[model samples]
Structures are given as C-alpha cells and as structure tokens.
Target: MQPIFRVQSNLLYQRLEDALQQGLELRLVTQGDRFCGVPIALDEEFIEILYLHVSEDEDSPEEDPYARTVWVIRIAEILAVAYQQSWSRDKLAQLLPTDAATSEVEES
Candidate 1:
C-alpha cells in the first residue's frame, strides 16, 4: 500500500515561494535533524536550497574552506520550517547584491 501524506496548506507554499524570491534563509526541521539554507526552488514534492559548508583539513586546522551545495529535500520529510533570524541573516545579507542589501537595510 502507498503511504499517506498530510495535505500541506497553501500558506506554507506561499511562504516558501516568498523565501525563494527574497533569498531569505530558512531553517528546516526533519525527523532526524535541522538544516539551514537559502531556498532555490520548490514543487509539491520537494524543495532545493543552497547549503553552505565550511570544512577544515585535519592537517591544517587553521584553514577552513567554504563550499556551496545544492540540497534537494523531500517535502514530506520537513516537520517544520522557520526563518533563520540570527547569524544566518547576516551571512545571507553578505551574499545578496549590494543594491538589494542596501534596500533591505533602508526598508528596515
């Protein structure tokens, strides 16, 4: 038998779309852990985000390289979603265009 999935509300979809449009950082909670990233795209079944990773080489612990990854996550696995209103916001601000960043600052 096929597993049943809960019907997600339109409000949730709208929020996700807004996040994708505005380059907002989001935190997603799944059954196992939490993930934080900027949304790239989404459909009924899944959402994609650019996940940033910083790794340090064991031999050179002082140097940490930054990596960006596209993470496609199943919509069904998302238990909850929230705006990352802390350091992530600051980090995303750095990634946005200067004009956009200035506009956001002016708006705020």
Candidate 2:
C-alpha cells in the first residue's frame, strides 16, 4: 500500500493547486481568516522565500528577511503552524512549510 504522505493523482490534485503541483500529503492552512484554505506542498528540505516574491505593499518598515512570508516558525516568533492547530486570532496562521527546522550546526 502507498504511504499516506503521497498525494493521490486525481481531481483533488488539480483543485488543490492552481498550477498543478503535488507533494507529500500535508494539511492546508489559511491566515487569520479561516474561510479560505491554502494547499501547501511541503518538503523535508528548508525552503527559502526570496524577497523578490513578496509585493511591495506587504513589506513592513522593519524589513525582516524572514517575516515576509509563511514558513516554519519558532514558538517565540509567532504561534501555531504545522502542529499547532488551535485557532489564534492574531497569530500568523499557515501550514507547516517544512517537515523539520533549519539546521543550525553543519557538520562537514
């Protein structure tokens, strides 16, 4: 039997992503407004959000490199994501973009 992580090839795939992208089965998340759900394709690898992608209107004056988009967040940073399903009105809500956090220590 195929692992549950795998996304089935069917109508769900097309509806999930507008451009037709697929990955391991992961939960979709929405921002403060829970009405709309965003299907997030997660990989074990650490993905980076290039500043170029974000719109100028969204950028804050603080200019944080990581604060612009949704990604794996530490408890101190925001609130719930990936695992934290409990609803918080202000906490930035999003699906777990990655399976694991970025490695701080690199062994050569």
TM-score for each model:
0.58, 0.22
Residue clash pairs of candidate 2: 5-25
The whole-model lDDT of each prediction reads 0.79, 0.30
What would the TM-score be for candidate 2 when compared with the true structure? 0.22
Q: Count the backbone clashes (under 3 Å) in each candidate.
A: 0, 1
Clashing pairs in 1: none
List model 2 lDDT by residue over 45-78, tens digit each.
Answer: 2221111233356545436433323443111222
Off by over 4 Å in 1: 1-9, 54-64, 85-108
lDDT of 2: 0.30
Top model by lDDT, which number? 1
TM-score of 1: 0.58
lDDT of 1 by residue, 27-74 (tens): 988999888899998877788988887876767664448888788888
Question: Could you say which candidate leads in TM-score?
Answer: 1
